[model samples]
Target: MAVPGMMRAVEIKAPGGPEMLVETTVPVPVPGQGEVLIEVAAAGVNRPDVLQRQGRYPPPAGASPLPGLEVAGTIAAVGPGVDPGAVGRRVCSLVAGGGYAEYALADHAQCMPLPPGLAMEEAAALPETLMTVWHNLFERAYVASGDHVLIHGGTSGIGTMAISLCRLFGITSIVTCGSDGKCRAALDWGAGHAINYRDEDFVEAVKRITGGAGVDAVLDMVGGDYLPRNLQCLAEDGRHVSIAVLGGAKAEILIPQIMTRRLTLTGSTLRPRTSAFKALLVDEIMRTAWLFVAEGTLRPAMDRIFPLAQAADAHSRMEAGEHVGKIVLKVR
Candidate 1:
């Protein structure tokens, strides 16, 4: 990588709409201590990017405010006290922010090696969805083999990732989606069951699928309207993890029911995690799940790719809820 004074990025001039994402040449960031500079080949579009553009989500301190949370590329430079050999190694990283740029900075510890045979687009899409699924299914919800799990948004990036993960781990996945197409698609990818949520009561459907026993865990992205129903679908001692609030933020859960069921409601955002904690998770996934990628047991499903300049189109597709899998931007 030659010294370039500036690099191309989609800068958010003001938070309002997708049109606010404007192309600009910003100063190329130099990796700081414990950081790595990644020559971003592609970046993944996620919900937080839309929220950031709407003035809802703000980046953490010392982070780039521009949207995009995950990126794949070759390491271009390593910070002081880091191994220089990391430069030029292929990687896809979970980033706090700044992923929309041609170059993005990541904690070296959070960098994930690109699995052999994974395309650049697929690699870029890995970080955000995989991190969310791993945290919710394994850590918070304690999903185990033979456990019945319900996931909302069955065809979106998180949904698709969850479907793949459940299949690989021997858990039974019952997913809910809005349309028949996505429902069938989820089933094809190893979802044990798919419910057309618009036409079916997910609570009743889960009970029927699990032989009236209900589900052991739930991964919910829709919060407001679906809260009570999620509780109803949970089996005794079940864990429900809410990762997003697409349905609305505030909702009520019956206290007595929760106590009787011994259900645990938990959630977390990946970007806010400490570097060491994320490093540990990365190590854990590498040890337990990397073989899936190596053996082709797991795959990153990509919905579409757009040139970096067409970020608005990418965001528009995601916002319209039309993408079946992850949307990626080729940053080059």
Candidate 2:
């Protein structure tokens, strides 16, 4: 297959709102050693992409400056050290950047083969949310079957994936959403309990739902004051994992409470990590979590698909806080 010299992509024109995302034609990137060129069919719109568009979360050093972080497509070309046979393979990849484009470059190790039954849009949604949920809920928090967890933003892509994964693994999940409608949606998505944060206190709700025992852990995205409240929702020897700080960065927590209860608090960002580490994580996923995905038992809760040129509208929908699940860009 011949690769094009130029391609259309969405670029952040200025550090501002969703309107800043503009489509432009630029020279298509060539794959470097250990990388592959992807003819993007679809790309997942995530909170990190929105942050990058706003100039809050910059891409890692030497990564593409474009906003998107995940993409699904066919491998158009392979670089040195990668098998030439990979050129025509279909995959969904966790890219560091450059996903909101007609063509994107991804590490060979980061690419996961797409199952025949999966749609490109659904495959695009898997890499980021699936890996994040698996690493945080199971690996970092050490949640297991029979464990109860409190998850924030239950209707978002990450939230829905967490809900489904927990349900599949026999872990009970209590999720918090902004409206009663979204709360109901979360419950229907297999969340054991859903609290409308706008109407009810999630900390109190978690306690009530768990019969005053508190949850085994909390998968929190809202930081700041929610940190202390999340701690309050934890049972003894519980874990709290923070993924995002959509609320505020700074927080005040009682040190004595952590000491007395032997609680654990930890978090991670996946973008800046080395490719070798990501490769190992991918290997682990292939052995465990990827089984369910391959079996067609786990599928992303898709919200809507926007054309690649309408990337700004996609971001606007995500920021509006009305979407129930994953929003994707149909680049093909």
- Top of the candidates by TM-score: 2
lDDT of each: 0.90, 0.94
lDDT of 2 at 314: 98
lDDT score for candidate 1 against the true structure: 0.90
* lDDT of each residue in 1-332, candidate 1, tens digit only: 56477899998889887888889889989889999999999999999999998899898887888788999999988899789888889998899899999999999989888867888888899888988899889999989898999999999999999999898889999999889998998898789999998898888898888888999999999999798999899899999999999889999877999898888999988877888998898888888887787677778777999999999888889999978989999997
TM-score of 1: 0.98
Residue pairs whose backbone atoms clash in candidate 1: none
- Winning candidate number (lDDT): 2
lDDT of 1 at 58: 91
Each model's backbone clash number = 0, 0
